[model samples]
Target: MQKRAFTLIELLVVIAIIAILAAILFPVFAQAREKARQTSCLSNQKQIGLGVMQYVQDYDETYPTAYYYKNNTATVNGGSAGGYVHMSVLINPYLKNAQVWVCPSDALRGVGPDNPACADWTNITQIGCEAQVPRLSYIPNSSIMPRKRGPQDAPNVVSMAAVDAPADVIAIGEMTDFSNCIFLGSTGQQNNERRNKSHRPVNAIMRTAGGGQWAGQSVADVTGPIFAITQAAAQGAEGWGGPADTRAITNTAGCRGSAADGGLHIRFMSPGRHSGGSNYMFADGHAKWHRFNDTINPNRFLWGRTYFPSGQPVLDQAGVQVR
Candidate 1:
């Protein structure tokens, strides 16, 4: 027998075949990977839901305050009397793993714990710790809490027993890198600080009209770089005393706007992290995914006045719950 090697033509044919196979299989493989990430993200949310339920059980059926406020402040954990404590601190103890707070597909993974961009639930030093916001991937439903910017003396705590439709109302879900709606420090003020300064007030475009902050405003009219707008607009319209009346998308990709001096706007929007919807933990401790439009369209009735525990038609200017 004589030693033989592949001829150039034959080698070229094999390489070409491989190239064709790679071209065909690469997308399939990418899709598979994404699907896995979505599943993992769902699992993370489910765990968080369980954690919240556990906390509620231990805390006399009362939902944990969206964030632990320092003194009387709401600017995140270390701003002053109103600093916000990370919500993760209140729920993570039940999860027993800080990683549950992160989504596998997170794009801005911070340098802290787990190599995933999420809050450092394992080592919570204080409210403004540099490592906290980067790790938070989810935010709580603020509609359940008293308005953060409203009167400090208002009753702000939302008890789990108070949620009207526990199965339908959202308890927790994927949030944009930055948010202006109610939630704890993880998705609100503190989270905003770690993002690009040019992107200040990141999720403003999702504003809807109604609440005193953005009364009579529409999501369509608000446009432009978020930072260019005034702090109020940048913060998005908040329903100071009740459920935000406007609607918005889950993620903040194309969002833009500045606050109107005294216009009403809706600021709460869901994050569509998966195929076309986002994973959510319902108030009843069930975790599921919902379509993007399901949350955006008021007609669908996923996120809105119905979700609020207060049965009142409107919140007082002080943001007090009128039952």
Candidate 2:
């Protein structure tokens, strides 16, 4: 038999077939990987839910505060100085693992100006006293636990028993860099940043001896209106529509938008961080993957009874009917 070499046409055909197979299979592989991440995220939330329940059982059924001043009466305006204690710090003991503070899909883990990645959460013994707290991939429900202050000028701590429905109350969700925000007023405020876009840097007030010290402009806080409250209390209610396609997603460092200093803002808006939707945990120790488009009934699933009481019409940022 004479040795023969393959013709150029045969090689080209083989290459074309391989390329077509790769094009078809690569997406499937990517989707599979993403699905795994989503599943992991859901499991993390479920564990967090269990931790929360355990915390409630041990602590008289009160949900942990998001972050609070050492002194509750130390108003930011009054120049009262006090450190902040984040919810992660409080919940970590229950979780006993620093890994749960981050989501697998979060790109900004341990990222900041000084740190290349998020700081190791293992040694974070104190929260409010530290200049920067351990960055987390999840955010607490500001409706049940307000960022700056609780409802009616109360502290940002709620009794778990107070919620109308524990199963419907959103405990925590996957948060991105842009998700760490608080609403100050409407879009028309004097210095308020436009909604649904990158918000203006907020002037953070660090803890100082006599009062709150101006820490300079912080990219962590975004001020707007309180949508988590009922329609009657939906002050500055409106949808902040972003013009750009990527505007809805969080920044790479996980610190994309603005953050509140002294936790001075109202509601914590959904970051739309995850693809299609986001993963959230309910107060009743159950986790659910909520699609953004499918969230027509904003009653208990979105925030809770405190924010969306029964019979309230679910509206978008523009005050249009969502359902």
Candidate 3:
């Protein structure tokens, strides 16, 4: 038999077909990879939620404070670390696995035991993390977590009994990159005492609006960005997570102003990092994914008021939760 080779036309056709297949399959492959990551993130959320529930049960049904300033003791300021003790530290005894604190899809990967913190100058170093603003880290619901910001005394925690609808309240959410506080959307500064120091506390949009640094403010006029634009436009332009109260998709300066100045909080608004949605751990010890807009729907908003252990609703002055 005589040796034969493919004709140029046939070769060209083969190459073209391969190119077409590559184009068609590349996006699908990418999406599959992303889906896996999202699933992994959800798994992390579920484990964390269960761990938190365990912590609550152990702690007399009280939830952990999201973050609190470490008081300086006689030992040394070096050991005191002069920083806040994060919620991740408080619940680690129950979590057991530090790895679950990180989400696979999290570009920031957030802080782990990789960063240690001091409970106080007298206490030894403990598992904790520290990060600057404009980061995509994990966040606990301030409404439920109760934070002790700055030098003031740690505020009382919201007990499990106070959560009227555990399933409806968001306990922990992924990617705190845009939100400055570890306590997601709780109010502070009751009785002229400053807690969670900054106007940033009120930046969550769905925050309980009562006396605090944001005493007189209102999210009523501040429109939800998803409502301001078409769904297609929002997905393409902002993809969730941006500066506080901003509707302009082009404006990417989420960290432009001081969180105390009340001009920014991009992380809370643009929280969804996985396929235009994010994972959340609900108070009822359930974790799931949700489209960002659905969480913010006024009829059933998930980011607002929880209650004090005394059964008083937070942001009590708002009569109804603000935003």
Candidate 4:
């Protein structure tokens, strides 16, 4: 038999076919991987919702405070500051697994300037992660939980019974580098980050304290808003159509206009950009995924009982990676 070799054009054609197949399959594979991560995140949220519900049952149906100081009256930077505690810590007993607080797709890992990876949880004890106090992948609804720093302000709590539509109200949502636990107040004074897109809680104040010191005193004593409050994205009462929100979301934030901070502004960044939407835990402890814009749909707004728009979403303002 005579030896034969494949023609160059034939080989090229085969290679081209392989390349085309790869191009088509790669995105599908990527989406599959992303779907897996989102599923894992949703599982975490489901457990979290159950844990919160169990916690509520034990605590007389009152939602846990996002955070509270052992010494609320402690002066800022005062040495006598009492170590603070977060909602995650309060519900750990119900969860039985500290890692449940983390989402598999968490890109920023945890809040704070340290930028610890998701695997690097706090170890000083009583904190959420191996290295941080409130390191978490989920954010509680501030409207129900209330955003209280170390101050004399009375605890503004919403009980399970107080919610008119428990199923429709959001109990918890995924956290992103740009997410504020306070929900979508992405306009004017409604902005949690009067500055830009950043974790409203993990600000300068959190940078001032260590994980151990935090376990011993309220973070507010040394910080401004270490307790992150939810979306605080570009939505308001009109359900994403709010005038200020429309201005913020319709255009690529910074490209169309300028924010007070002088950075690229984007009114809304999808919290669940992993899958076009993010996972949420409802007040009833049921968890599921939802589209970001859909969460604020005029006919079906789910952030809370009402909406308010404020803040300009500064894309560059977020100090960490969300993807």
Choose the strongest candidate by lDDT. Answer: 3
lDDT of 1 by residue, 3-83 (tens): 999999999999999999999999999879978988998898888778878988898887765544343435222332233
| Model 3 CA lDDT for position 295 | 66
Best by TM-score: 3
Model 2 regions more than 4 Å off: 72-81, 110-128, 131-133, 148-152, 178-272, 296-301, 308-323
Name the candidate, 2 or 3, with the larger lDDT value.
Answer: 3
Give me the displacement of residue 242 in model 3, in angstroms: 4.5
TM-score of each: 0.61, 0.64, 0.67, 0.62
TM-score of 3: 0.67
* Each model's lDDT: 0.47, 0.47, 0.51, 0.48
Query: Quick one: ranking by TM-score, best first?
Result: 3, 2, 4, 1
- Kindly give the number of clashing pairs for every candidate: 30, 23, 11, 30
* Alpha-carbon RMSD to native, per candidate: 9.9, 9.9, 8.5, 11.7
Q: Which segments of model 1 are wrong by more than 4 Å?
A: 1-11, 73-82, 110-134, 145-155, 178-270, 307-309, 312-323
